[model samples]
Target: MKAVVLERFGGPEELRPADVARPEPGPGQVRVAVRAAGVNPFDGKVRSGAMEAVFPTPLPAILGLEVAGVVDAVGADVTGVAVGDPVFGFADTGSYAEHALATTVARKPEGLSWEHAVTLPVAGETADRVLGLLDVRPGETLLVHGAAGAVGSIAVQVAVAAGVRVIGTAGPGNQEHVAALGATPTTYGEGLVERVRALAPEGVDAVFDVAGKGALPDSITLRGGTDRIVTIADNTAHELGVVFAAGPQQRSAERLAELADLAAQGTLRTTVAATFPLVEAAEAHRLSDSGHARGKVVLTV
Candidate 1:
């Protein structure tokens, strides 16, 4: 199998294309013939050794977290999914390869292309999880920072469809994009507090800080405490008494399926900023690391 292996962790330049042995599924797992792999910020964090303390991977490992592909082999005890199924899920063996291993695979909906399907596992899962954590209710205004990024974009739509008034933060150019997803768009920066205040005059009920770009202090000020503020990007959330929610336990195949169904029904949609061939994994990481891509970066096999 051809894979983008991280010989060492430091920079996107560390990722290199190489011929590695194809992974075989163990018990309760299945091997996927990867069609497209999702590139996440977490993948870059892992690649840079920033998350080594939390998600330690052995050196010379493949570095993607989610994939959309066809099931080529099923391990023992796997029932509902079978070989030849087009599936998308978290890739247990890392997904930056021609073939990867997955434990909780869900059938990819015909309505989604492989690139879009790959985004559901990570972006959708995170959005669903954070919304549950925030307990966002209909009629209440929820503010999301970085509202135009992959996970943030999904969160915006999910909150809106649930009947919540959503205010999302993005760049000036993405204001319309965020608004199109049913959120009142505000630019994130120096005057974010006033901007958000201008939109939600009644006050924000909760703050979901997906961007983590020093929005915590303002969020605390708006909500009167860290009780209603949660962050995924800033490691200093604990210092500010805010909740930092992450890790794989938050995602599941069921959540991915729900997101897929939403996309199939034209309710939830994923933006593909760009797609790179498997060999250009390095370039893909470069874009992801820049943190400026407006949508999910995908790698096609």
Candidate 2:
């Protein structure tokens, strides 16, 4: 199998394409013939050793977390899924390759391309968890920061579908795009607080910050407290009395299945901003580091 391996944590340059042994599924797992793997900000964070304390990976390891592909084989105890079934899921490790192993695989939504399916496992799952924490309801206003990014985009759609009025922050160029996702786009810049205030008048009911650009504390204060504020980007937000709701189940199979169904129904959009061949995983990471991707960056294997 061809995979991009990290010899050591540093920059995108550290990712190298090489021929490695294909991973086989162990008991309670299945092997996926990876079609596409989603590149996430966490990929960069882990590669650069920035998130070492939280998600330490062994050196020379493959580094993708989410993949969409076909099941080639299932290990003992795995049932309800069989060989040749198209599936998507979050793997423990090693998804940046031609084949990876997964313990919890869910059926991919019919009609979705592999590129689109790969985007759901991570970003969609995070959005689902945040929405659950906030308990966003119909007619209430929800505010999301980094609204044009992967997780924010899904959050917008999910919140809107649940009948919540949503206001999101993004660059001026993406205002219409975010608005189309059921959010009122507000500009995030020098005075984001003032900008959000101007748009929401009565104040927002919830805030989900993924930017970790120092906007969360103020965003929550504007919404009137720690209870309505939840952040995924900054794990330190936990100590600040805000919700830090990320877990392995943050990318659970059940949640990805639901997200895929929404996509099949045309109610969800897992926009693929761009794609690179599996060998160009380094380049994909570079694009992701730019911090302005409209949606996910995928590596097609």
Candidate 3:
């Protein structure tokens, strides 16, 4: 199998294309003939050794979190899914390769493209998890920072579908895009507090901080406290008494299936900012690390 392996954790340069041994599925796992792989900010952190304390990666490992591909083989104890099924979800092994292993996957809807399918696992799971943690109810206004971002955009749509009013913050150019996602769009930085307040005169019920560019303080001021505030990007969450959601907890094949269904039905959507070939994994990491990508970055096999 051709994979982009991280010989050392330092920079994107560490990721080099090499022909490594294809991974075989363990019990309750499946080996996928990867069609596309999702590049996330977490992959950049892992590549640069920033997440070593939390998610220690052995050197010379393949680095990817999610993939959309066809099941080539199924391991023991697996049920319902079988070989030849097209699937997408969290990869058990690295997905920046021609083949990867997956333990959590749902059948890919025929209507969904492989690139779009790959985007759902991480963003969908994260958005759904944070919404659950916030306990957002219909009629309440929810504020989402980085609303035009991959996870944030999905969060906005999901919240809107659940009948919650959403105030999404984005750059000036993305304000219309965020509004298109069914949220009241506002720009971050400088007058963000007043802008959000103007949109939600009744006040924000909860805050989902996806842009870690120092939005927590303002979020606190708007929500009147740290209650129901969650951040996936801000490391200062602990000091601010906000919940820092890290890693997966509620990710399941069933949940992924539901999300995939919504995406197939055109209710959920993700923006693919760029696509790179598998050999250009380094370039992909650079874009992901830049934090300026307006949508998901993907790698095609």
Candidate 4:
């Protein structure tokens, strides 16, 4: 199978198109003929070795985690998924390839495209997890930082659907876009706290910080506690007593199915910021690393 292999992690340029042995499914896994792969910030972190201390990948690792494709093989113990099934999920062996392996997956409804389905596993799962972690209930106000980006935007819609009022922070250009997602949007830099306060006079019930642009302190002040504040971007979460919601404690196949159903029903949505050919995985990673992409970046295989 052809894949964008990282001979050694360093930069986006390290991802090179090459032929590699196709991966076979292990126990409880399935092999997929990958149609598209989602490029995320964590993929860049893995490629650049920034997450080496926590997520160490060996040399010549494939550099993607989420994929949408047709399943061609299923391993022992696997159930509810089989050959010829159109599916999307997280891949343990990486997804930037012609074939990928997944231990858990959900059926891709006909309404969802490959590019869109591929974006859900990581970004959608994380958004749902943080909202669950906060136990954000209906009739409460929530503040979402980076609400215009992939994960943040999904978080906004999920919260809104649950009847939680959302106040999202984004660039001026994205304010209206966030508003369309059911949040009162505000610009992200200075005066963010004041802006949020102005929007939610009763104060926010919880804060979801996905941008990590030094907003943790203000979020703490607004929420009046670190218990209700969670972040995926800020490493200083521990120092500030905030929960670093990085692990997959709240993730599950059932949740992925629910998200896909929402997307299929036009309830949850994500824009394709850019799409690159399989050979141009490097460019996709560069766009993701730029931190300016307005939506999910994907690689068509």
| Each prediction's TM-score versus the true structure | 0.97, 0.94, 0.97, 0.95
Per-residue alpha-carbon lDDT of model 3 for 1-301, expressed as tens digits?
Answer: 8999998889899999999898888999999999999999888888889889888888889988899999999999999899999999999889999999999999999999999998888899898999999999999989999998888999999999999999998888898899899998988998888888788888999999998989999999998899999999998899989999997667789989998898888888778879999999999989988877887999999
Model 3: ten consecutive residues of lowest lDDT: 247-256
What C-alpha lDDT does candidate 3 achieve relative to the native structure?
0.91
Model 1 pairs in collision = none
Candidate 4 or 3, higher lDDT = 3
lDDT tens string, model 2, 1-301? 7889999989999999889887778898999999999999888888999888877787888988888899998889998889999999887657899999998768987788899988888887788778888888999998898889988899898889889999898887889899889889988767877888888889888898877777766876687778788887776686677877655365467767878888888878778889999989899999998878888999998
TM-score of structure candidate 4: 0.95
The predicted structure with the larger lDDT, 2 or 4, is 4
- Per-candidate clashes, comma-separated: 0, 0, 0, 0
lDDT of 4 by residue, 1-301 (tens): 8999999878889999899999888899999999999998888888998888887888878888888999999999999998999999888788999999998789999999999888788887898789988999999999999988888888898899899999998888887899899999899878877888898989999999988888999999898878799999887899999998776445578888888888888888877889999999989988988877777999999
Query: Which wins on lDDT, candidate 2 or candidate 3?
Result: 3
> Which candidate leads in lDDT?
3
Off by over 4 Å in 2: 235-241, 248-251
Ten consecutive residues with minimal summed lDDT in candidate 4? 245-254
The Cα RMSD in angstroms, rounded to one decimal, for candidate 2 relative to the true structure is 1.7
